[model samples]
Target: MRRRTLIRGAAAVVLVPAGLAAATSAAASPRQKSAQADDLVGVDVSNYQVGFDYARAANEGLDFVVAKAGGCQLSEGPYTSDSYAGHVDGARAAGLRVGHYFLTGDFLSPREAADYFVDNLHDYRSGDVLALDVEVLDDSTRLWNDAEVSTWFNRVRERVGAYVPWFYISTSALRSADWSRTIASGARLWAASWGANDGSYPGPPDLGGSYPDWAAHQYSSMGSVAGTSPIDLDLARPWAFDVSGPTDPPGGLPKTSAEQDGVPGPTMWKRTQNWLRIQSGYTGPIDGVPGPNTYAALQRNMAGNWGYTGPIDGNPGPMTWSAVQRLAAQHGYTGPIDGVMGPNSWRGFSRFINADAWD
Candidate 1:
């Protein structure tokens, strides 16, 4: 639904290092120099970018690609981008780290829009970056509120386990709304600000103190890549495309008061309640009681990845424990995933939830 208004001359092809980061420029200022040295070169494409040659772009030193997944269009309502799958597949095939973004519109509620976005995502893997693009609504007078935007991010995080999604917005449009809640939701900034529009890499954007630092900067929409001309170019930090697994808590997993008897007690439940409160949308008191509220939030968080497709009824059935085991497998649970919770499973789950962050 968004279109580039300006088309500049072909960008000067800048060679990137074998690694993700690029070399610094001596002619630039101090802030610009730092951005150039640490930022990775990447491009974002939608259906408008036709027949994009991903391999050629990668050969030209591009490190990543963020393709448009789906969003609500002003005319068509909620719709998925037809080219989303091809862009993701081609970018991955070309050895480029891939990401996906969903454009938000005024048609649907933020929760519904986020659910649609996650449902329409193609070939999603852990560590793949996700983003919510919010810009000015040309056709509608209503702008997205802070709580609405936060709801979108929180809903997406509920489905996808770890990692925060990037929040994309231009400097002017961001000023039009209060984003305190969205910021508190842990969504990183993908600041968009084009200065001069001369196909030159702009320095660190002036976010007007809205964010401490940006995860990615969309500096030029008219920049040229090897295989694609007049494309949206971005400079992103290494954390923007980090594919490493979730970072473990400091000093490793803490000891839980639960006995090694395979049954979770009050202490473990309390910690889990706190985790669900922070990560998922659990608003219940942390009374260490494993009630329906606790299990319901856990089910929402596991629905996307752990294969818990049932309702959030707060009832932990065999399917619920099975999904919990699937999650525990990543944290050192080697036992059979037979929907059975045993001592080993408890230990592994404790390894995951027994973090100081939760406590």
Candidate 2:
């Protein structure tokens, strides 16, 4: 992969003026020398903001946007923001480099949330970047720790498809958390160190949460543009994304490592329950039992999608077996959907939703 030549100073002398930060150094030269167009300007928005005029923002010299698409609610659970799609379309219509972020938390498995995020959000398009906006730990409880942050970002790595997902966070948070080195190795970072006029970076512009320089810096959470009073205005160095490389081939486990190979164990059954809870109509505990409720939900899902129509009595009858085979067929099993779930179905099941254990 090709790397760009990045500017260095470690820390800025002072905050640059708001608007676009690229030309700050030029503005500071004693000889009145013209500085190269060094940085780009952008904004981030979410459901909280009333509205934005993307066309006006573009005309005002903004170069990019990082909008919010989803949020992690400790008690309420994960949900897509109401306005993300509109914001994205409007920003792109205004001809801006568009990206998006999703707030994360510590309640669920980081990987599980990441998977859901990737699945539910809009597809990534050209020039689109994804970010983990680790803003709050929890409203009423603990903040996300290093381990949680690491799992979130690491899982994010596998699920972000082609986009390079950055870690958007505050400078104080970066300094405080245990800091996931795993995330640092693969993810870009956007540091949130706010001031009155934060649209520009002054020093080496490096952030310490395991990064040499922050890919983007949010100078003001209350930035104004196109007449909007408070928008997240950002200043970013020229950023390039490396979207190609070897990612581990997906699939191969029904759940992480449930009792070794094909052998079905109580431990494996429990893990299956954990994965199963995410399916529709599963309102039971993850007790690892293949009880009526569990099988009922499974059968329900398989019925319409996998060509099954037996009584939903939570019974693992021929119809249920046929459904599993059909589901596996969609994933990777080329064989017939017979009652016998052979190696082909096992491989496909692993591929479709395999985790070592419960997510």
Candidate 3:
């Protein structure tokens, strides 16, 4: 998440993660909650979190990083997030997935904000997901009703191709603004709601409010990680849809997941084929459902020390799981060989599948 094209004369308010204006406010939040480190860890930082250390934060179990990319400053007009460049380079170096966001200023039209957003993230690859911060940063700035938000988002989509944008808004703002239209308009959303570490927040934003469920929830803006403090804590549900475009750290992992495809049909196989291409130079169709050609390609990859004794059938079973487990073990997994594929297992296997989404 680096800089984007600036929109002049427009006023925009950029809230630090968790609505805190600064890191000192991390303490102002409710007491830190205790949760499993294995949970998906993330943080959103702006210039307010000065001298941000991307490596240390990743070591702190950070799985992803969201950096402020666009915002407007009075006379300054629109500018990229001052910290965008450093955060983007550092986060990639630390082996973390990256996401970008734009703070919609008050004075600009929806299309202007959308175009600027697209330009700023123009360098982002298909692997990256763009987001729009839909809250009113300044009390004086007019609130963006659901229709306006949707307009900005759709325009962004028009510029960025198939890459879907995630809406980042506080739960309270969502309620106060009556944002049902905005929520229902988009296919995915990331709800911002803060509370103790007991992990009491519901799985998605208000389930009954607008969208059926949230793709991610910001549990705490002031939450602490093992290696980083004053960072936002979030839980992202595995996405069920497929996303593709240029990727951050080119040739890295794509953001799609098996859960995102639901029940692992042809779409799941398509991702596997793409991963195989990366690993062994596969040249098969990326169609979600693969036929004999896919299994044939897979057999070629299983040769030598890759380990697979089963027939060259595309159908994956115990033998296939055993081979997959063996590969996972090579990729730093020490779990029991019970043939059970856990998150850690997936992490190991995904590397062979798609390097961009190793996490």
Candidate 4:
């Protein structure tokens, strides 16, 4: 009973161990509910140009992008092809759904890795995704145990929130790790079982490679998209919006769950984070951690410069929630500033958050 069972489709059961219960306590916030395949079309960019060219693949029908941020440093040299902030901005400008990934290994302790990831990626805005690039077999000396890996993932999620979906790269290197026991627990599985698409899988079969809610499969590395260079397999679907239907303009900000009674504190916090990302041109993960970058962006966009002053800290407090509510009201949302965001509030904010305003 302590275990959480995630039922996919009809009879498929995906069980998350009780061990991960505390780590991923927050629920997956409601996304726009687009069909998985429709939103499944995204690719990872590492050795590409410095800036993302949205218009580059505009003709190829590229719907989303997952890029490398930073991970444990290597003695051979640090990979500096792209900074986290630049990728976020470039992807946004290029009209692509964006996400960030970090290489994982014993390069640093889980807490240190977490802290490094946070510090490096504080400027992410509302519309992007944050992913951990957790596959590499260099020095096994710095890798974390399962519990540590899970904790690190949860820490990232708690900080990033629902706007950014957490994805794991399931490959040979990752599957061979000791922490492999809990590989696909809370995060979506992005399978890299490269094999012949002719009904033959060449990777580890028991690698927890099968999940009903599995978001994507990287079936091949010898494929190519329209504008980009040849790379791994494409996403099995298209990009999805966080909320369904037409979202209203920006509205009033969030209030506390304690203060709002029925409203959930985490949900309000997520709304605050989402609003700041949208307003401040941040396209990083939407988790609720409120790192330095998230704070800096909030400060930059607050009322004086088109942003209502929210909590000055990187964290989302009542003031930030209030600002979101008011801004949304400007776009025809008439919700209360009580901070208890029901479907009505979300619908309103969704409009502005995913609006043509980016145009």
Best by lDDT: 1
The model with the greatest TM-score is 1
lDDT of every model, 2 decimals: 0.69, 0.57, 0.56, 0.48
TM-score of each: 0.59, 0.54, 0.55, 0.48
Expressed as tens digits, the lDDT of each residue in 246-353 for candidate 4 is 111245334434222433345444554554443333445555555677655554444322334444455656666666565556545687886555655555555544
- After superposition, the stretches of candidate 3 with alpha carbons farther than 4 Å from their true spots are 1-39, 73-76, 176-187, 196-204, 226-228, 240-359
Can you list the residue pairs that collide in candidate 1? none
As a TM-score, model 2 comes out at 0.54
Question: Candidate 2: which stretches are off by over 4 Å?
Answer: 1-36, 137-140, 183-185, 197-210, 240-359
**Per-residue accuracy of model 2 over 1-359 as CA lDDT, tens digit each:** 00111112122122223454433322221111112144577778865444788888788787888777765644567667667788888888888888878776645566777777777666468457777777654431545666666576666656644455567877776766545353333455577776434333333222431332356667655456776644566666454333422122234223534223544445555545544443223556656667898887677556524656677678787778887776666556688877776666666665544533224
Instruction: Name the weakest run of 10 consecutive residues (lDDT summed) in model 2.
Output: 1-10
Give stretches of model 1 more than 4 Å off. Answer: 4-36, 137-140, 242-359
What is the Cα-based lDDT of residue 256 in candidate 2? 36
How far in Å is the alpha carbon of 273 misplaced in model 3?
Answer: 24
Per-residue alpha-carbon lDDT of model 3 for 1-359, expressed as tens digits?
A: 11223333234233334434344333422222223222355667666455667777676566777777866423345667766777777788888878787777665777887887777763486756677776655322655677778787677667767664677877677656555445334435677866453333433344223332355567765554543455566665334123533222234334446443223445456667664442322455676666676765555345312455566556666666666666667656678666566676666665444433221
